[model samples]
Target: MGNNRQTLLLSDSGYDCENKTGEQMLEEAKKNLQSMAFFGLTEYQNYTQKLFLKIFSKNFKLAEEFAQSNRTFAETFINKQNDTVQIPYLEEIKRLNKLDIELYSFAKELFFKRLKDFRIV
Candidate 1:
């Protein structure tokens, strides 16, 4: 997505990305943990497992294990960081939560489609 679009999404999630620090991002992500369950357990579990596996191939099982250990696995998965690549997993999830249900459903569909394109699920 373009930077402007991303910024708008962040705004929808109540995150002022232009001014927020890394700590603020992490804090917001933590606060969003409870709300993440709205995704439903089974769907969250499947998505987490598949996404993690797709992103971190050899570490797929690690993701599964982490899910087992963390009851808020979906939130935790969403908060995962890749410092080297600078991927903002948490922020993405936060934006997702802010979207209307129809938009969110479309986003999920795109997500699953990408996974399928990659043969990850």
Candidate 2:
């Protein structure tokens, strides 16, 4: 008898699609970020940090009181999938104010996504 087998489609997770890494999911997100000029090395990091804070702060309003608002930041937060740990990158987002920090990481992703869309990178 001839062997007949069906192969499964694998997602980015590399296991049939479910293990989206932090960087992966973020890149595939919305595309509405802006571009700012940078000349110094640290300036790049600083820009990402500031933009990131704007993104999350919009999502988590409670943290808004803790950090300066991003003028061109998006006006929405992403719905959670399963509530995995998201505080580590978010916590240090702004300045350890906890709330702002979370927003920072998220907003930063948005910034990158936007940049990617406009081919800013």
Candidate 3:
């Protein structure tokens, strides 16, 4: 089987990317990016949120850095009709950890494998 990269859309009831300004879209994407479901657990979600908030509150620059995740995330969204974008939250974490590309690629593959395994389970 081939690696199919089919992506999904992020649906906002109103004021989404299609109708919103670039700044507004980025703001919304930042907020939406902070979800625990992508981490696959409530604990991970809460912890990451807290850590991000702490950093953001103390140093605004760092918060914006986390928010900058949209750049990589956009690659997936742009291909929503074709390739599947794995969870951006994990990608954000990897970026924050300053892990190299090879490590991140492995992390991505692991996420796909887990997602596949989840379907089987």
Candidate 4:
């Protein structure tokens, strides 16, 4: 099952699969996984404050609970964003925002999917 899925992704992503050894294939797969994970992290870092604000506007208590339980630094980070002229973590955010459309899309989908877990549905 895993090999079938990997084959599909490799073809879809334009990998040249004809002569690659199994170790080579495995290394490529690992790299892809790491890249996707990095995208997801960058997406969360870039947009978590927006998510917090949206939750705050709708359900203040829930938002507070979420921050306290899941993101203890959220309030401080938001305050820094508001009080300073420069955005916090701008470089990290731009890492996703400026490159790799496929990775950006993957990160975006992962970010929005958290809305369900956060009970925003």
Candidate 5:
């Protein structure tokens, strides 16, 4: 006896099959992947913000501003760069508030290290 198998292709809605073509299925897969990636990034960002606040519990506003600025800088500059470079706003924040420079440096290093390790930088 010969083994026979059948594969079923379901539409994105998963209720029925409309006889979609290969290209259509590929496009649907790409859309789903992009959506999943976006969702994961969003969750990661939220977690990072919470972690930052927890680390700098005494200066929530400063931590929030710095996080926001860093996000903007990364999106606008670091993401486009091929070479590793310094983050711009940390020094300004340190000078403005007489913050613990070493602590700030350590936190920044950890953040970038995590990004690099994840290959997101």
Candidate 6:
């Protein structure tokens, strides 16, 4: 008899849903976390929000660097650009947010593999 197992393909993830090595899964988790963190940072309006997201993402260095660069860019843009000018990275942030949501769902499924019948509230 042949093995009857089916492998699910996570949308846009390029990950084989079954038989993933632990390291590969860990790498995927890292990618998801970072993407989500970037989304958070792009939307953050205050220091408290940034700090919370930094903790959630477990990437202090990235958070610090991003914060500094964002501040510098905003200052420069405001000083040089008029209100009619559009910020360049807004579209990139939107794209990342969409991708992050998908990755987050994929990670959730990977996390609850053993409890497939259970629903997260």
TM-score leader: 1
- In angstroms, give how far residue 78 of model 5 lies from its true place: 44
Query: Which pairs of residues collide in candidate 5?
Result: none
Candidate 1, residues 33-75, lDDT tens digits: the string is 3234222224556665656566666643662344434356655
TM-score of structure candidate 2: 0.25
Q: What lDDT score goes with residue 61 in model 5?
A: 67
Q: Candidate 6 residues 5-107, lDDT tens each? A: 1111222234453566434544565554545423323323344344444446455344243343345566776677654554565555545455345455554
**How do the residues 80-105 of candidate 5 rate in per-residue lDDT, one tens digit apiece?**
75543434454454454332333334
Question: Candidates 1 and 3: which is better by lDDT?
Answer: 1
State every prediction's TM-score relative to the real structure. 0.34, 0.25, 0.22, 0.25, 0.23, 0.22
lDDT of 1 at 1: 28
Error of 1 at 113 (Å): 0.4
Instruction: Score each candidate by Cα lDDT.
Output: 0.48, 0.36, 0.38, 0.48, 0.41, 0.42
Q: Candidate 2 on 35-99: residue-level lDDT in tens?
A: 33311122255444554445554564443333334432222342342236445544444333432
Q: Residue pairs in steric clash, candidate 4? A: none
| Candidate 3, residue 32: how far the Cα is off, in Å | 26
Q: Which stretches of model 3 miss by more than 4 angstroms?
A: 1-99
The candidate that achieves the highest lDDT relative to the unseen native structure: 1
Superposed by TM-score, candidate 5 places the C-alpha of residue 95 at a distance from the truth, in angstroms, of: 62
Error of 5 at 110 (Å): 24
lDDT of 2 at 96: 32
The local lDDT score (0 to 100) that residue 79 gets in candidate 5 is 65
